[model samples]
Target: MDDLFARQDVIKRLLNESRRWAFVGLGDNPEREVHTQARLLQRRGKTIVPVHPSAATVLGEKGYAALADVPGQIDVVGVYRRAEHAGAVVDEAIAAGAGAVWLPLDVIDEAAARRAQEAGLDVVMNRCPAVEWALRR
Candidate 1:
């Protein structure tokens, strides 16, 4: 396993400090793992920004069609797409100038992560935010 994707300190800091998270692929469907993860963070007082094609409000948070569409400073961009699509989201996050790019479990894009890191964004890939958050406690 590549340690590049498992930065314990990065995960802890993001989970503890970042307040706004743009969850890509998060939609109205509550069944999706992204929704659940976003909700878990939302319940912890973090603001959730849903970035989905639907652009529908999710978990009481406004939705945007893309990362570029989200207004204000986005602390973290949660990548919930399939591995193949994660790179695009990461690139978008970098372009959006987000503080960090978080690729949840099963989503791994080393090239994207490297690009985001090179862009000065904190990265945590192939890790579940909910699990990491819980592990912190």
Candidate 2:
């Protein structure tokens, strides 16, 4: 990934100003990191759109099976799946024309990140939005 890809300012903007965050792999289990992170983002006033095949509502928000299924524009796509699965989600985010792609802690894919950057989408890898919010807020 290029410097612009993981730039702190760009990531911060996504973490701060992005209103609609589609969280891929976010399910109903409160024990999952995605679940808690989604809640934290919601607490900070970001609209969290859950994207899971389960199609379960979470944190009072309805769920969609995929990013393309979401009706409106998505500012950021927060990927919560395994490292192997994150690339596909990143590609989907790019295809969906999202402003940025956020790969949470432990979910890293350099090629996917490069793809996202090449697509003109800001990329944040191996970082947690909730932690970033804590530091920035």
Candidate 3:
């Protein structure tokens, strides 16, 4: 799992280079970890696009109802959903032509991760963006 899901090089590349991050499951709820993580990355100069059913603005960025609804290029789709729901989000990310899919800490979907990799998208699973960014910094 370390070699596949926790690849340091991939994590560094995504966190270092990806500018646009579409966070799935991020909504108006600030109490959620997704909100906090998005805020953290946003503070670091990354563009955060909230994607949820409500499509409510989060972190001052416009939100999209779904990955397909997001326009332009999406560098990374952060799957903040639960493990069971993560696979579908990863597939959606692939369909949306995202450059990468990041399933934050505790969200593990090996099959989905492999599928994303097969689709030529960098996959980071079972890892926290904030932690990775801090360690790398």
**Taking the tens digit of each residue's C-alpha lDDT, what string does model 2 give over 1-137?**
44545578977788768899999988999998999989988998999999999988999999999999988899999999999998899999998999889988888899999899899988888887767777886
Residues 1-137 of candidate 1 have per-residue lDDT tens digits of 59887878888899999999999999999999998999999999999999999999998888999999999999999999999999999999999999999998888889999999999999998888888877878
What is the descending lDDT order?
3, 1, 2
lDDT for each candidate structure: 0.92, 0.88, 0.93
Off by over 4 Å in 3: none
Write one digit per residue (lDDT tens) for candidate 3, span 1-137. 66697899999999888899999999999999999999999999999999999999998999999999999999999999989999999999999999999998889999999999999999888899888888986
- Total backbone collisions, model 1: 0
TM-score (all chains, Cα) for each model: 0.97, 0.94, 0.97
| Candidate 2 runs further than 4 Å off | 1-5
For each of the candidates, give the backbone clash count: 0, 0, 0
User: What residue pairs are clashing in model 3?
Assistant: none
